[model samples]
Target: MFRKASRLRLDGSPRRVVLACCCALFVAASVVSAQQPPAQRITTNFKDADITQIAEAVSMATGRTFIIDPRVRAQVTMLSSTPMTPDAFYEAFLSILQVHGFIAVPSGDVIKIVPDANARTMPGTDLPDRPPSAADEIVTQVIAIKNVSAAQLVPVLRPLIPQYGHLAAHPASNVLIISDRAANVNRIARIIRRIDQAGDSDVEVVTLQNASAVEVVRIINSLYQQQQAAEGGGANPLRLAADERSNSVLVSGDPEQRLRIKTLIAHLDTPLESGGDTQVRYLRYADAEKVAALLKEQVTGIAQAAAPGGGQQAAPPQQQIDRNTTIIADPETNALVITAPPKVMKSLMSIVDKLDIRRMQVLIEAIIVEVQADKTAELGVNWAAWSEDDDTRFPAGGFISPVGGSSLVNLAQLAADPEAAAEAGIGIPNGTTLGIGRIAGTGVNFAAMLRALRGDANTNVLATPSAVTMDNQEAELKVAQEVPFITGQFTNTGAGGTLNPFQTIQREEVGTILKVTPQGGSWRT
Candidate 1:
């Protein structure tokens, strides 16, 4: 058996060894090609080649497997301007297939060259994750709408797609379904995203008080159309509608566009004679003249402050008014006739609202008391009774006690019997503090007199005065009199420095006069 084995070993076949070596080399080359396949440059000029022949050529060049559907058969004519790599060749091959009304759909390891119509219903490969390499490569994409209506976009995007392509919107999902070439699908998706973006889209109704709404809207639309003509076109279209019955302008568009339209409306929505820049707003609580005066002064001050060196030479009479708009008051109607742009009017009205409110009032009551410190106190309305014959004097005037209230009350009462009161030398203004002088025989009277009761009741009550005023207002109450006092006296020399009576007298208030200022506000204040 050993000798037979040795003989067989020596008789081994060379063909078998050669076959093994060949297999080894082939496996090594396959592994190297799989790791890094060398790029192949495709240079083809097919004058009139069958579709199958073209497919075969593409397969050989790209080293990719391909299967042609029986329905796909056409003679194609194409030429390569220059050599192209494998990727570039694939792109060109797709274009060629598309031109011939065919498409190549990738199916598991093999690419299927099928009729374009059949490719849609073929299933699986019809849906691609992203756009393909070629512009004409058919694809389907679903784009959801966020801001705009999806069904509306179908009509817009349908024109962009080829006749063989499809565009539809699923109303329930607000999503668009588009099927076209890869490039067209991507383009449509981008358009959908841009159009569906969130914007300042709202409807504003502005009431017109003095201007005609229809005319205003017409003018605004004309201006918008002119602007569009200037810009060639605008992506965002503004819609201005007018309700004549309500006399209001309806504006609908993106926020920025709507703002521009509103500004125009604010300018146009004014009385015809008012020039769209003037307004006569009637005031309710504030004095129109006062408000106008203050605002004009403020505007003038600001203009002056803004000028170089505060102010230079004399300015035009209306220069100050023109520089910062105009504010004039109407006295007859108690209205504000404003000559300014809508922007200035808006700010002015804001201030007017705050200033034209009715302020709360304050009721202030003051009690004035004149207390005599002496134990023997008199309700002291002093009176005088001097005998004309004798120079002696006696007190004679109206009196008041603890039991009786004020006597010889006010000037109104004194005027009632002025003739009789003047006979008693009581002819003085209400401000004077009466002096009680008495003649030796004449009777005397007093305003009030009271002695101490118990030991501490030595005070007398004089007057109680009150006044009502608005918030932050001042009030004065005077139940008082003015009495004359000698300020200075001069004596002339009468025949050797004898006394000569010359006096300077000053009259000052001698009784109660109360002044009060009260401020009112909210809790924190």
Candidate 2:
């Protein structure tokens, strides 16, 4: 029996041993390949190629050209302009292609840009003429303008028109929606003057004393057509009208068709002048940040309404994406409005809708602590104020007193006497010290404990003296990156006993409460 056991342990069967080794090798290869990043191939000749490959190829072959097909007829319409750089030009061109159903490929020294390769060409079809101007340049300029605000617009305008910033927040509060064809330039100018005189009134009404609805409609129709021509019919006037109606009120009823007149009450940032005349316009601001923040709040509100718990987290938990997109008063001025990319906007909406309720406060506190952590002096409006817009346990613009309570005490009020608040432990403002209870026995899980540690109470809880399980392993303490504050490796000795096997433990700042694990895990608080 001993001799048989020794032979089995040695695995004397060569074929069986070879098969097992081959299986292990196969699994190892699969695991390694699975861990590798997805590959992309980019081809200059073909309409469809991998993006990653193209980026890589471009980087590799700086100035080279390779012809994909010589048989295809080259009745070319060359529209070219030298921009800041080849890369910038390519980016701008790519943006245009994304909007349009077309793609461009750079082959060696030459680029083989094409429409859908699968499309069948129609006989006697008149191809539309490409716009004369550099589309990329126009788009870049428009995006830059869209990203700024009226007040921020000062510096940019100051160089052109002095004393721009000093002109007050709202020089003209009224809005004017004009038609592109209507020769009512002077009329709109007068309305602007009146609005400018209103001087920061809550409701700076712009009175359109002249220009009938028909004329405005005609101008809008023309503007719509021009936009359609530029964008290949992606711009819809009806959609714009719908958005306007959704945001504000409808003004007119069509004489023949019974359609309502569109009211453009929203402020405009840039002065829209086409054909050397003032066209359809709105009273807008460059502050896209303010608008973006408001939109995010609205999104959050909508999410909270859908949530049964009356909090950010959805009932069925969903993944949260960091949506950095915002429509703020343009940083440069309140004269123009810009928006983050559509994806950014969509992500922001997703956050408002799908924020984890359990992690809602966690997310908020994390942002607050993270922002203030750097002690950066250039902190803008309190982000908490924006988040407060949602009907949460916390009051809007006030100190959140244990979740749900009215009477908002702004940060200014809290900072008035931080020491007293810290000492009393009740209604202590942000940055005030508060005591945290370190309870023993099986009361709260490690997750709950960590949450409390990072809570407003600001207490550190040590779990070395207590029992903790790591994946059904009877361990005194389990530490991993998933558990915040633990900044080291997790080693299991399989001893199953209370072992003091701490390799290294690093301390954090005074406010930090680092958690040191028995298996070489320590939190840098």
Highest lDDT against the true fold, candidate: 1
Residue 497 displacement in candidate 2 (angstroms)? 63
lDDT of 2 by residue, 1-525 (tens): 001111112246886567445544533433343233434222222122223223223333333332222222221111233212334424543454434433333333454434423112211111213221322111101111111123333333334311111122221321122211011223323333443321211212122322322334455566555543433221111322222212222232222112322234222212222211112111232134544466666645644454556456454321121232223334444321323333333344344334222211111011112222322121112212222222433322322343221112322234557666556553522332322222223332111101111333243433333343222122322232322244565555656665454444555443333333333234222
**Distance from true location, Cα of 176 in model 2, Å:** 36
Error at 511, model 1, angstroms: 74
Worst 10 residues of 1 by lDDT: 1-10
Pairing residues by index, what is the TM-score of model 1? 0.34
Give me the overall lDDT of model 2.
0.30
Q: Provide TM-scores for the models.
A: 0.34, 0.13
Q: What is the C-alpha RMSD of each candidate to the true structure, in Å?
A: 25.7, 47.3
Candidate 1 local lDDT, 382-499, one digit each (tens): 2223343345554343343212232343322345577765675554432223322222334342232222222233555577787887777788888868899999998787997788
- How many Å off is the CA of 139 in candidate 2? 56
Q: Please count the clashing residue pairs in each candidate, in the order shown.
A: 19, 62
Give candidate 2's total backbone clashes: 62
